[model samples]
Structure formats: C-alpha cells, structure tokens
Target: MRLTVRHTTTYRYAPPRRAVVQSHRLTPSVFEGQQTIWWNISVPGAWTGATFRDGAGDRIETVSMLGPVEEVLVEVTGEVETQDLAGVLRGHRETVPPTAYLRTTRATHPDTGLRELSADALAGADGDPLDRAHRLSRAVAEAIAYVPGETHAHTSAAEALSLGKGVCQDHAHALIGAAIAADMPARYVTGYLFVGDEPMGEASHAWAEIHVPELGWVGFDPANRCCPDARYIRLGSGHDAQLAAPIRGLAQGVGEERLDVSVDVAEAAQSQQQ
Candidate 1:
C-alpha cells in the first residue's frame, strides 16, 4: 500500500507580531514495514528553524522570518510504500529485548489511576493480555463517548476516566493508564487512521502501543477496537500526547494566543513500486 499525507498548521494573532519560533514533528519515517520514497516540507513564512527525519534519525535547518509576520504555515508532503506484515509483526521479535520498553514516564506512572492495577486484575472476564487490553480499550471507547465539547489536549487520563467522556486522545490516555496498571509498558503513539468510506471531520489521530515481552510494540486503538493495519501511518512516539505533539513552541511575549490546526491523510490512488 502507498500513502500520501498532507499536514498543514497555521497560527494567527489578533495583534500583528514581529517574529516567532516553532518546532514540528510532522515528518513520517520509514520503518520495519514501510519505506519512504519521497518527502519534503514547506514553510510559507520561510524556515526559521526545522528538523527532519525518516523516523530513525534527525537533521536540522534554520531560517529567519521575513518581517511583520502574523501567521506561519508549515506543510509536509510525502509518499511511502508499505508492506502487509500483520503475520510477521504479530509474532515476537527476539532481536529487540522486551525489557527495553519497561522504562517509565510521567504519564505511565504506576500510581496513575488506571496504571495502579495489574493486567491480570483488569482482565476480569478475559484472561489473555491481548484480550484484556482489547476489552479495556472497548470499555474506554464506550465509556468515553466521543463528545467534542468534553475534553482537550490538556485533559488528563485520570480526569477523563473520572468524567467517563472524551475523545481519541482521552481514550488513548485511559488505555495507557490501564496498560501501565496491568504491568505493561505502554506508550502514546501519534498518527493517522483511515475510516474507509466513513467521513471524518478531524485530520490527525492518536492511539496507544503496548510492549508485550516477546511481541514488541503492538498498537491498540481503543477508539477503534483493533490493531493498526494498513490505514495507520505513525509519526512518532512518546510517553503521552504532549511529549509526542506534532508541533510545540514558546514565544517571547505573553498575552493570550489562539491556535488553529488542520490535517489531511489520504491513500494515494497509485501505489509505489517497492
């Protein structure tokens, strides 16, 4: 399968600003099952500073803003060829030790509500790890009915779990919490998932990935009960959404600023030859 992704982010201020600085994590990398054919990024305001990578490495570039710049736009366009490795990925990868993923983070804290419990206890009716994880993900998806006004990026997993409502980000966090509690090393993955013929109003997507002793990192979309298959395009990984945010930065001046973001991920009509 081949995918073409177009991600654009723009910022507008009430009062015109002289300059600004921004960081982005929008580049898609070629991994075990995917290959990047061509990729590029464009910034309308001119590249003040930038970083690029094919997922495993990094490169940096810096440029200065013209003048009286009020808005900044960053666009990334790329084509990637992916192979179907469901069978291969489902099995364990002995080369990469499972213990490598046990390290903890703020979001994966063992004391966090969901992470406090063991997977065995959370399994309840289900005994298998995968089964337990799926059940928990589904429960979260159902419990947190996708309400737009219910949550935001800053919403915490414990808060969402307590409120019983939120979006994919919240669901991912809740799932991560549950996995950590179950004694699983789980991490947050920021990416895109296609809904086939179904129409979606949002651009980017979020899901959780757990490291099973031998199986390595397996993706679980609590929002959509299943592993990420061909529709999923991973951008990066972090302990939580904030750490793996696509774009983040700090401005010298302090006031109140509004942010507007848009994303588009679609399967290219033609698949690239591997």
Candidate 2:
C-alpha cells in the first residue's frame, strides 16, 4: 500500500514573540515494513538547524524563527510505501534499550486500578508473551471507550481508565501502563492512519508498541482492537504521548499561542503491496 500525507500546523500569537525554536520528529520510519518514497518539511522564514537521528532511530530536526513573529507555520508533505508485517517492527535500527521504556511518565503511570486490571486480565491464562500481550490489549479495549473530546492532552492512563472514555492517545497510554504492569516493556507511538473510506480529517493517530523476545517491537491499537498494518504509517515514538509529540518547541517572549492543525492521509494511486 502507498500513502500520501499532508500536515500543516499554524501558531498565532496575540502578542508577537521575539524568537521561536522548534524540534521536529516529522519524518517517517525506515524499516522493512515501510519505505519512504518522498518527503519534505518546511517552515517559512525559519532557519533550519542541526539534524540527527535519535536513539529510537527517528530523524530529529530543528528550526528557528527570529523576529517580532506573530505567526509560524510548519508544513509536511510525503509519500510512503508500506507492507503489512502483522504489526511487527522489523529492520528498524535503534540504540535505546527496551528496558528504557519501562520507565513511566505522568501520562502512563499505572495506578492501583491499572495494576489490578493487568493482574486480572492475565490471571490463570497460561500462554506465551505474545498471547499475554493480546489479552492485555483486549482488556484495555473493553475498559476504555473511544470517545473524542472526553479527555485532554494531560489526561493520564489511570484517569482515562477510570472515566472509561478517551481517544486513541488515551487508549495507547492505558495499554502501555497495563503492559508495564505485566512486566513488559512498552512505549507510545505517534503516526498517521489512512482511513480509506472517508475524506481526510484533522486529527493524527497514535498506538502502543511492546517488546517481545520473539518480536522486537510489535504495535497494538486497543482503540481499534487490532494490530497496526499497512494502513498505518509509523513515525517517532517515546515513553508517552507528550514526549513522542511530532512537534515541540518554545518561543522566547510571552505570547498567547493559538494553534490550528490539519492532517490528511490517503491512499495513493499505486499500490505497492498486496
């Protein structure tokens, strides 16, 4: 499958700022399951800075805008060819150890409820690690309902589980928390999902990746109740949604920031995989 993506993010300030700096993880992952056909990122009037590959093997780039800048825009356009690997991440180079992901962030810290949930989900179920992971994903899906606008960016996994409603971010965090409770190393993934039937929408997508002995990193989307496949385009990843954010930066001056974002992911004309 081939996918084309267009993403634009704009920031407006009530009071113009003197300077702005941003770090981006907007590039697609290079792995056996996916190939980048063409990609570009642009920020008008901004000077491009250092570029390097992070420990997770995601490309990181920086940009700076100096002025009484009131508005800044970041645009990304790309095409990628992807194949279904049953959600198994293969041939992706990374220096970070799997154990590093075991560390919990504010967004994914498991509470008492989450610990119990994990225990109950795996209780008396004798199977390999893969089976256990599937069971945990199913349990999370049953616990949390995918309801947009029910939660915000700072909502933690415990809160989402207690509320029983959240979007994909919450689902991913909750699954990560549960997986860690089960003694598995899990991390958050930020990416795009191609909704083939409908017109493009404003939101991007997220999922969770767990490390198994047999499989290095396997993706699971509890909100959709399935493993990521060709329809999904893999991007950068981190311990939580905030850390894994595609864009992060700060402005020098005090300016009330207003943000607008639009994203479109669609099937390309040529299909590269069956």
Candidate 3:
C-alpha cells in the first residue's frame, strides 16, 4: 500500500523565547516493509544541524532557532510505500542490544498492581513467548477502555491500569509494563496509523514492540488489538514515550509553551504501468 502523510506541529510561547532547539525523529524507518517515496521536514527560520541515525536505526535531526520567536511551525510532508510484515521488524539495522530495553523508565515502572495484572493475563496460558505476547496484548485492550482525554503525558502505566482507561500511549505503556513483568523485553514505538476512511486518528499513534527470542522485535498495538500491518508506519522506539517522542526540545526564556498538532494519513492512488 502507498500512503501520503502531512503532519504539522506549532509551538507558541506566550512571552516569546530567546532561543529554541529541537531534536526530531520525524523520518520513517528504513526497513524491508516500508520505503520512502518522498519526504521532507521544514521549519522556517531554523538552522538544521547534525543529522544522524541513532543506534536504534532512527534518523535524528537537530534544529535551532534564534528568537524573539513567539511561534514556530514544523511541517512534514511525505509519501511512503509500505508492506505488511506481520508486525515483525525485519531488515532494519540497529546496534542496540534487545536486552537494553529491559530497563524500565518512570512511565513504565511496574508496581505490584502491574505485576499482578501481568500474572493474571498470562495465567492458565501455556504457550511459547509469541503466543503469550498476544495474550498479554489482548488482556491490556480488555482491561483499559480507550477513552481519550482521560490521561496526560505524566500518567504512568500503573495509574492508567488503575483507572482502567486511557489513550493509545497509556495502552502502550501498560502493555510495556506487562511485557517487562513477564520477563520479555519491550519498548515504546511512535508513528502514524492510517485509520481507513477517517481523517486521521486523534493524533500520531503509539504502540509497543517486544523482543521475541526467535522473531526479534515485533510490534503490537494493544489499543487496536492487533499487530502493525501496512496501515502502520514505524518511526522510532525507546524505553518509553518521552524518549521516543517525535519532537523533543527546549526553549530559552519561555513563559509557557502551548502545542498544537495536526496529522493526516491517507492511502494514495497507484499509478498504471506503461
């Protein structure tokens, strides 16, 4: 399938910051399942610097803006051809050991409740790691109702599990916690999910990727109750959401930072061969 994506994020500072610096993971991953047709990232009045691929095989670019800048807009326009790899991340190069993901962050730190949830999710399930992973994903989807606006960036997996409701990020976090509790290494993935016939999902989507001994890293979206297919585009991964955020930066002398994001992912028409 071919897809086109347009994502724009605007940041406004009330008092107009002196300077702003941002790191982006906005580029799509290079893998067997996906190919970039055309892609670009634009930030007016910003100097691009030090673009490099990280150990996780994600392209990272830096942008610096000198301000008196009240507003900054970052725009991304791209087209990609994607194939369904059954959520198995194949043909991607990365140097980081999968065991590195076993380390938990603040958002995914498992408490007693999360541990118990993991136990219950896996109880009476006699299967290999892959089968058990699916079961755990289903458990998370069932346990947490997909209710947007119920949580925030600081919300933890334990909190979301206790509430029994959250958005995709929360679901990913809770599922990551469950995977860790089961002794399976898991990480958070940030990317776009093309919800067919819709303008877009609420925002750019997030999911969990677990390292299966035989299959390597496999993507699972508990919120959607399935593995990533052609409809999904993988961007980057980290121990948790913040680490894998598409945009992370700092503004000097900011009164307050307000952000607005718009994303649209749609299937593209195939061209006829001559």
Candidate 4:
C-alpha cells in the first residue's frame, strides 16, 4: 500500500522569545516494511541546520527560529510505499545493541502491578519469545481501556496500569514495562497508522517493539490488539515516549506556550489526486 501523510503542528507563545531550537525525528525509517517515495519537512521562518542519523537509525534534523518568535509552524508532507511484514522489522540498519533497550525509562518503569501482570500472563504459557510477546500484548489490552483523555504526556506506565485506562501511549508504555519485567528488550515506537473501520486511535500512533531471538524487532500495538502491518508507517523509536517524541524544542525566553497538532494519513492515489 502507498500512503500520503500531512502533519502540521502549530505553536503560540503569549510573550515572544529570544530564540527557539527544535530537534525532529519525523522522517520515515528505512526498512523492508516501508520505502519512502518523497518526503519534506518545512518550518517557516526557521533556518534548517544539521541533519544526521542516530545509532537507532532514526533521522535527526535541527531547526532554529530567531525571536521575537511568538508563533511557529512545523509541517510534514510525505508519501511512502509499505508492505506487510507481519510486524517484523527487517533489513533495518541500526548500531544500537538490542540489550541496550533492557534499561527502563521513567515512562516505562514497571511497578508491582506490572510485574504481577507480566508473570500472570506468562504463567501457563510456552517459552517461545514470540508467543510471550503476544501474550503480554493481549494482557495489556485486557487490562487497560482505551480512553483518549484518561492520561497525559507525562503519564507513566505504572500510573496507566493503576488507572486502567489511557490512549495508545499508555498502552505502549505498559507493554514495554511488562516486557522488560519478563526479561525482554522492548522500546517505544512513534509513527502513523491508517484506519479503516477499526478502532485505531489517530492518524498518529505509538506502539512497542520487542526484540526476540527469532525476530529482530517486532512491532506490537497492544491498544489495537494486533501487530503493525501495511497500514503503518515506520518512524523513529526510543526507550520511552518522551525520548521518541516526533518533535522536541526549547524556547530561550518563556511565556505560556500553546500547541495544536493535526495529522491526516490516507491512500496516496486518492490524496494526491485532490
């Protein structure tokens, strides 16, 4: 399948700042699952700076805006060709060792509840790594209800587990925490998902990738109760949600800031013809 994506993020500050710098991980990843046809990121009034790929194989680009900068806009427009790999990440080049993801982050820290959940899910299960991963994903889905506003960006996996409700971010965090508790390496992934008569959260999506000896890194969306497939667009990943954020920025001078984000992912032929 081929997909077209239009994502725009708008920012407003009550008081203008001296300067603003932002780092982006918005570009699609290069792997057997997806191929980038054309992609562009535009930040009006901001100068484009350095560009490089990190150890995790995610593209990093920087941009700066000179103040008094009261408003800023970051836009991403792209098209990609994707194939169903059954969520197995293949042909992807990355320097980071799989063991490196074993370390826990604040957002994915497993508490007693998570530990118990993981143990219970695998109690009578087989030893196959892939089967273990699937069990954990199912456990998380059954435990947490997908309610959009039940949590926020700073919500931790432990907190989400206790709440028993959250969005895709919470589900991913919970799955990561549980997977790590089971002595597996798991990380958070941010990307886009195309929904058709399904319960997909939004055009933008978050999921967990678990490393198995049989499969390198398999994408799991506990929130949707399935492995990522052709409808998904691969992006960057990190130990947790904050680190894997598509956009992270800082303003030299501060006033209260407001942000709005909108994303649309659709079939390339249909979107392009418009």
Candidate 5:
C-alpha cells in the first residue's frame, strides 16, 4: 500500500530571541517491510546548517534561526510504500541476535513508579516470548488511560504504569521496559498513525517493536492495540522517545524564555489523476 504524510511543527517563544539552533529527525528510511518513495522538509524561519546520520542510523539535520525570532515552523511531506508482513513477522528468527537498545538521556533513570516493570515481572510470565510480549502490551494498554497533559515527555515508564494515565509514548515505553525485563530485545518507534474512523488530532504517534530471534523486529502499538499497517509511516527507532524526538535544540542566549510547540499530522487527499 502507498501512503502520503504531512507533518508540521511550529515553535513560538514567549519573548523574541536573538538566535536558535535546532536538530530534526523527521526523515523516514526504507526498512525490511517498508520503502520510502519521496520525502522533503521545509522550515520557514530556519536555514539548513548541516545533515548527518545519528548512531541509530536516523537521518538528522541542523537548522539555524536568525535573531529576534519569535516563532519557527517546520513542515515535512512524504510518501512511502508498505507491505503487510504479519505472517512473516509473527514468529521469532534465530538469525537476528538479541541486543539491548541503547538508553537515551531522558529515558534513563526509571521514575519511582516505573521500577515495577523490571525483568522480574516479565520473567514471571508463563508463556513464550511472543505470547508474553503480546499479553504484556495488552495489559499496559488496558491499564493506562490515554489522558493528555497527565504526563510529560520525561515521565518514566514506571510512573506511567503506576499513574495509569499517559499518551502513546508512555504506553510504548512501558511495553519496552517490560519486554527488556523479560530478556527480549525491544526498541522505540516514532511515526504517524491513521486514526481511521477516529477524530483527527495533533502530533505524530509512538509505538514499540520487539525482536524475535527469527522474526527480526516486529511492531506493536499498544495505544491502538494492533500492529502497524500501511497507514503507519515510521520515522525513527531508538531506546525511547527522546532519542526519536522529531526536534531538539539549544540557544546561545536565555533569560526567562518560554517555549511553545504545535504539531500536526494529516493524510493527503487523493489527487484527481489517481
């Protein structure tokens, strides 16, 4: 299946700033089950400074903003081709070795509540790795309410687990923590999900992928309680949300400055030709 994606982000500052520097990881790459046909990014008040690939092989770009800038906007548009590999990705594969996904700065220290999802909980389960992981994901989803503003990006998986409230990011992290504790290799995936009959909303989405020895990396979106389909356009993979964040940046001057962010993910309408 083919999909077209449009992601737009805007940053507004409380007070006008002198300059700004930002890093972006909004580009998608072709993987075992997906292919990128075309992708491009545009920044209204920023200029591309440099581009490189990060440790996880994600495409990264740096942008510089001019002085007295109060707002910055970035837009990404792309199309990808995807195939359903549910059957092939179901079982484990021996060829793919198990490896720990490197931790990110924010996802490091577990919050007080998140510690309960340690290896012990996973090992205690009486089932195969795949079955265990599926059960764990479902449990996390059912346990947590998809509440906004209840948790921030830095909230730990343990905290989310205990609070029983969080967005998709928290669910993904909780599932990852549980999988890792279970002695399974799991990674964080950031992307956009087609809401289908649900209401359109702000921002992209987040999910988790576990590695089965033979199946390689298989995705699970606990927030949606299903595997990713053609509507999903993967952006990057890492240990947690911070690593796959669409944007990160620093500035030279700072004094009582407030940060504001807005994100939009929409599906492109079919063209007349199509």
Candidate 6:
C-alpha cells in the first residue's frame, strides 16, 4: 500500500519571543515494512541546524528561529510504500539494546494497578513471549476505554488506567507500563495511521512496541485492538510520548503559546485519483 501524509502544526505566542529552537522526529522509519518515496519538511524562515539518525534508528532534525517570533509553522508532506509485516520491525538498523527500554520514564512508570493488570492479562498465556505480549495488549484494551477528550498531554499511564478511558496515547502508555511490569521490554512509537482521505483535526497515532525474544520488536495498538498493519506508518520510538513527540521545542522567553495541528493521511491511489 502507498500512503500519503500531510501534517501541519502551528505555534503562536501571545507576546513575541526572543528566539526558538526545536528538535523534530517527523521523518518516517525505514524497515522491511515501509519505504519512503519522497518526503519534505518545511519551517518557513528557520535555519536548519543539525540532522542525524539516533541510536534508535530515527532521523532527527533541528531548526532554530530568531525572533521577535510571533508564529511558527511546521509542515510535513510525504509518501511511503508500506507492507503488512504483521507489525514486526524487520530489516531495520539500530544500535540501542532492547533492554534499554526496560527503564521506565515518568509517564510509563508502573503502579500496583498496572502490575496487577499485567498479571491478569498473562494468566491464560503459556511461555511464548509473543503470545504473552499479545495477551498484555488485549488486557490493556479491555482496561481502558477509548475516549478522545478524557485525557490530556500530561496524563500518565497510571492516571489513565485509573480513569478507565483515554485516547491512543493513553492506551500506548498503559500497555508500555504493563509490559514493563511483566518483564517485557517495551517502548512508545509515534506514527501516522491511514484513516481515509477526509480532512481531520488529527491523523497522527501512537502505539507500543514490545521486544520479544523470538521476534525482536513487534508493534501493537491496544486502542484499535490489533497489530500495526500496512495502514500504519512508523516514525520514531522512545521511552514515552514526550520523548517521541514529533515536535519538541523551547523559546528564549516565557510567554503563553497556543498550538493547532491538522493532519490527513490517505491512500496514495485514492489521493491521486481525486
């Protein structure tokens, strides 16, 4: 499947800031599951600082703007040919050891509830690592209801689990926490889901990748109750959402800022024929 993506994020500061700097993980991941066709990222009037691929195989780019900066726009347009590899991360090069993900961050820290949730999820499973991982994902799915506005950017896995509702980010965090409690190394993935050609307020997505002794890292989306198929586009992975954010930045001065994001992901054929 060929997928096309358009994502735009705008940041507006109430009072102009002195300057701004940001790190971006907006490029798609290269693996057996997907190949980039053509991709571009544009930030008007900003200088491209540094670009490198991190240990986790994610391409990172840095941009800086000298202000009186009132508004900044980040735009991304790309196309990728994807395959259904059953969520397996194959033919990907990365130097980081999977065990590194066993270390939890603030957002994915497991509480007693998360530990118990993992235990219950694995009760019916045997010794297969992949099977246990799938069960863990299912458990998270049943535990958290997918309610978009039930949570916010700062919601942690424990908090979301207690509430029993959240969006994809919450589901991913809950699954990551539970997997860690089960002694399975897991990480958060930031990506795009092909949700059709219709304009949407958001198209970006999140999921968890569990490291299995037999299959390496496998992707799972508890919120959607399935593994990532051709419809998904993997971009980057980190210990949690904040670390995996597509755009992470800071300004020189303190001021209130508002953000608006719009995304559209469609099948390349469908987009071209229209």
Q: Which candidate tops lDDT? A: 4
TM-score of decoy 5: 0.81
Q: Which stretches of candidate 2 lie over 4 Å from their true place?
A: 198-203, 270-274
Number of clashing pairs, model 2?
0
Candidate scoring better on TM-score of 1 and 5: 5
Candidate 2, run of 10 with poorest lDDT: 194-203
Candidate 4 clash pair list: none
lDDT of every model, 2 decimals: 0.64, 0.91, 0.91, 0.94, 0.70, 0.94
- Report the lDDT tens digits of candidate 4 across residue range 101-135: 99999899999999999999999998799999999
State every prediction's TM-score relative to the real structure. 0.79, 0.96, 0.96, 0.98, 0.81, 0.97
Please, what are the lDDT tens digits per residue for candidate 3 over residues 1-274?
9988889999999899999999999999999989999999999999998999999999999999998989999999899899999999999999999989889998999889889989998998886889889988999999899988899999999999999999999999999999999999999999998887553255389999999988999999988889999999889999999999999999999398889999988787632221
- The pairs that clash in candidate 2 are none
Candidate 5 residues lying further than 4 Å off, grouped into runs, are 87-98, 102-127, 200-203, 255-274
Model 4 scores a TM of 0.98
Query: What value does the lDDT take at residue 8 in candidate 1?
Result: 72
The candidate 3 region of ten consecutive residues with least summed lDDT is: 265-274
- Which tens-of-lDDT digit does each residue in 37-105 have in candidate 6? 999999999999999999999999999999999999999999999999999999889999999999999
| lDDT score for residue 219 of model 3 | 93
For all predictions, the C-alpha RMSD in Å is 4.6, 2.6, 2.4, 1.1, 4.1, 1.5
How big is the positional error of residue 199 in model 5, measured in Å on the Cα after superposition? Answer: 3.0
